[model samples]
Target: MEKYSTNAINADAPVMLATERLLLRQWQRRDLGPFADMNADPEVMRHFPAPLDTQQSNDLAARLCQLIARDGWGFWAVETRSHAEFIGFVGLRETKPDMPFGSCIEIGWRLAQAHWGKGYATEAARRALSFGFEVLALEEIVSFTALPNLRSQAVMQKLGMHRAPDDFDHPAVPQGHALRRHCLYRLARGAWQEQQP
Candidate 1:
């Protein structure tokens, strides 16, 4: 594994991991503007209910930072190694208890629309999965998305995660919300190890 860096806001915060082309690092002030812009973009937020306003975007970023500070890991702020630009986030986060796959760690990613189709999500997520299995010693990591989010599901498949039989409605979303219905995917630690050389 490549050595990870910790050029975070402070010593308390640390860069979580690195991939060949990306760094999964602690959130920085420089990330806020692009993050808010990405959250506000309609096309980027299309799979969700609606785009986030500036405050909501800031709140979400704050929460992600807090989670990482508390647990030493969460959805990490991702940057391109070449330009050191903050594109978005990709890492592991604790799944909400109300969800069908209760109390599990999940791997997820969201990048600016301009950064899509470059295989960044898959590359970063593979690093996150390694952290989960190798460092955290987790048995499995799960991922889920609204049924229509085939693009995200494709990433899960590429990472060797298999869909589970049960699909559930996301409790946080309204009961009848079009995006409430979600598909679950899981990757066992053994399965992840098998994929390695």
Candidate 2:
């Protein structure tokens, strides 16, 4: 998936964005431990195929940096501002053409098991969406999850995205697999701006 050049405003001084409880920022070398710990959780990987090891986590960090440099958008290392501890990641990615949709960018999040249900995903996602449209001037942003992933779907809804029923099976996942089938939800730039409080 090739991400388009973004006009998203650079975070002044790279200062982190603070939600009610979370902080979104660039990944740090120290983030590897917590990131690996989160990826090693089986329940967290349940929605996907498998948990990643340390080497995978390290590689992912490097890869994410490249993506951020190239597209000005990538998964942000998320933590708690109060505690200043690493929790997980939340941000955006280019929607693969293989994915079931038109040209799109996807908003996504993943938190450690301990951080689940803390509203971190929704809060951080709201900030990312703001950066995308209000700053990047994106035409649209979308999100998707497996048919069984009601939790993620709820988060998308909370961010004001509406379900787009014309979905297709994810080619990345094997056919007949539980996670292959997905549902897409989208929010246009105008619609998202109007929903701003």
Give the alpha carbon lDDT tens digit for every residue of 61-156 in model 1.
Answer: 999998888767889999999999999999988777788767888899999999999999999999999888887778889999999999999999
Q: Roughly what TM-score does model 2 have, to 2 decimal places?
A: 0.89
Candidate 2 lDDT score at position 126: 96
Q: Report residue 176 deviation for candidate 2 (angstroms).
A: 2.1
Query: After superposing candidate 1, which stretches have Cα over 4 Å from the reference?
Result: 1-15
| Model 2 segments more than 4 A misplaced | 1-16
Give the lowest summed-lDDT range of ten residues in model 2: 6-15
After aligning candidate 1 to the native by TM-score, how far in Å is the CA of 22 from where it should be? 0.5
